[model samples]
Target: MMDALERVTGPANATPGAASSAIAPVLAGPPQPVRVLAAFPAAVYLEHATGLLAVVAADGVQHPNAVVLSVGVAARPLAGLHVGQEGTVGDGAIGVGQLQVTVARWFDPSPHLRATSPPLIAGKIADARAHLMARTGSDSHDLAVPADAVAEALRSGDMDGVLTAVRDLVGAGPGLTPAGDDVLAGLFAAVVTLSPAVAPEATTTLTRTLALTGGAVVDRARHVTTAVSAELLHHAVRGEVADLAAAVLHAFTGRRPLTPALDALLAVGATSGRDLAHGLITGAALVLATAEAGDPDRPATTVGAR
Candidate 1:
């Protein structure tokens, strides 16, 4: 059984005269002690023993696992905390060492991306790809080979190939969230979330295959990547993505404008955004191919060679 803390929700522990802060509802896990993983001026990440990660951010971007503070909470206060410091979640606040942030409310991260016409989704995907290509130059370190392998595997419904490509990506780059891991996360989120819409008849088979793949990805990630990235992968497998990534997905399905959301995602950490965008595009394209493969009258869609 999953622990209550994993559920990430319960009544806040209210304290007298304490002000509440807004948290991404997903981050408000049951009150429990946590240890600081990393600390920066803009954000502090806390890790639960169960391997869940939560972030306290002083910015407007509401990461899936973040507790967003109001403007009143300055970056200076977060600067005082250090990695390895102990903390607690209670009294409607997240206390890390001497820093305490109360929970005022929990906000939904984004509207769920609903099913839309495949032609519209395809056009948005093309637009997003063009935007990414125009804005970012080629990188010598790009994960094109492994990413394509994964997309091709998904396109052909080859579970073994998917796992092999995913293994290659688990720890393939540098950073807290390595570029390869980001790609995998984006791919996993897109496949799990969009497959049903794109290929309704194959949904059952795809879901079973993805459940197996997602479990293996999480298991492999625990051994190969940073704990923060591993935790994020775990959530991604379950179709929970960072708000920035979710925005791009929203656009891909035609619920919102593609360029603005794509630009916002592209502006994330040096290469993380672009890598994620690539993965999202690849996964969406694979969905189109899978749909075509299931329909005799439709021409097979070519999964991108890039």
Candidate 2:
């Protein structure tokens, strides 16, 4: 649970408003955390004063339509707090608050939120972060793709070969690539040798490398690596400037830039192009689809008195 918050916070740090806006609506008002975890990628659980409302997203890649995950009749506020209040994020709990609760993927992969983890992912996340810091020459490592490896991987058809090589170098975090790893040394060299304007020249090489990596497993592996990277960025990106334009674009079109901070948090939040390609998948289940399982006119928005 703690790990998930830290992980997603990586990219969120770069784009504070975007991150804050994302969880704000869902945790609108206050109440006890009834459940946490995603059955789909772009899902949000809302615990308000009146009731427990599951926000059925309508974002294309994450939510094609609005659908509810679950609804609980709440006589009292969630997290034992007041209505219209937010929580302060902390180490153990999702955030320190007495209002609306925000549950993270780390706490509950299951819809039931029964299987709590031992925070082991925290260490793995730290290792990945340390690896990035050492190799990136700075806290951030975007634009530094291993061109030689990417070029070679492009020539080679073996996606596994590409990933194996990448794991060897950067040790995998955020948006790592097979070729990126094999030529990380060279990639860094290319960036350094070149002017600051072209420091991220490795990006072109990495894009080409992905074409060769091929298929589901490699793709999922990339996402997993991204999750790891996102966790590491928790320290690097937090409190930094966030890109609202980029975030909005991501929300509208399932694609995100190859940015380190963006990629890392996107993976952790499971909001990448790969994760929510349909704008209908939240963390685990398709709540929107489920909500409109039978009805055709899915209520787009609430008509409340302003």
Candidate 3:
């Protein structure tokens, strides 16, 4: 299903040559044709021979493995494309079936949450949770049990507990990006990206912990989730996320307003936005707990206490 951003972007008459001068650097090597894995009104998922996934979005929302088309590109043409249709990506343009889109921009989707006092970070997280609950009118969802287990494990620094809960969460719900997988993606991205910022003093320990848990997530995800979701989880483990998810993280770091950024995220898929939000809040809370665990002076905190 198309997300809110895709629906809003809609279709436009594409002038592919108009932005020729502004095209960013193309991917390395000779162009290779990719198979369409899925096509939507404003987005197309493609698979390369190497098994890597790439997304082409008309809305210009960036992902680590995505190509943002120029605003002039017509999204309607993408909807007509079928899975397994041939496409070629290189030289700043993507040609799929009868549709072609010029690349206008590229970005690294990995989030960088700025370092701040733990108290300030905690307050930002609290505000995010409150805003989410107010918007959704609920603090928990269908996968709350496993989700809470993951958060609790993180809070107590129990790697074994985390892995056990993660096994239950992956591929547990419906959708191309299952609700459970979305939660895990959000959790992995938040924890991997925000840990160092919240606990600079514990960087070594955090890094090691992330490596072990992140590797486990990637390995298990491939076997349990859809190809698209598994790929997303792999990226999330490395701290890369969709633009909306990144916006929420940025807001938590005081880089943007919490309500608007979070509201935009909450508008995504049926429950994807809320599930990701829950995971983000859980992951943020975990950061605070982990940081406090390494520092005796910091006050104790529990996961999901909010």
Candidate 2 regions off by >4 Å? 1-96, 99-148, 155-160, 170-306
What residue runs in model 1 are displaced by over 4 Å at the alpha carbon? 1-31, 72-75, 90-92, 108-111, 138-141
Please report the TM-score between candidate 3 and the true structure.
Answer: 0.84
For residues 164-253, what per-residue lDDT tens digits would candidate 3 score against the true structure? 889889998888889999898888788888887778665445455666787787788888888788878877888888889899888878
lDDT of 1 by residue, 1-306 (tens): 123223343234421112112233223455677888887676678876566545445553455566666642354556678888887764345776666665555544433668776677778777777777688854223587788788777665678988888877888889988989988888878887788766767545655677877788798899989987887788777777777888888888887788999889988888888888888887787777677777788787777634
* TM-score of every prediction relative to native: 0.85, 0.23, 0.84
Candidate 3: segments with Cα more than 4 A from true spot: 1-26, 72-77, 90-93, 102-104, 154-159
Please state the error at residue 18 of candidate 1 in Å: 16
TM match of model 2 to true structure: 0.23
Per-residue lDDT of 262 in model 3 = 90
Which 10 residues in a row give candidate 1 its minimum summed lDDT? Answer: 14-23
Candidate 2 weakest ten by summed lDDT: 276-285
Q: What residue pairs are clashing in model 1?
A: 8-29, 20-103, 20-104, 21-102, 21-103, 21-104
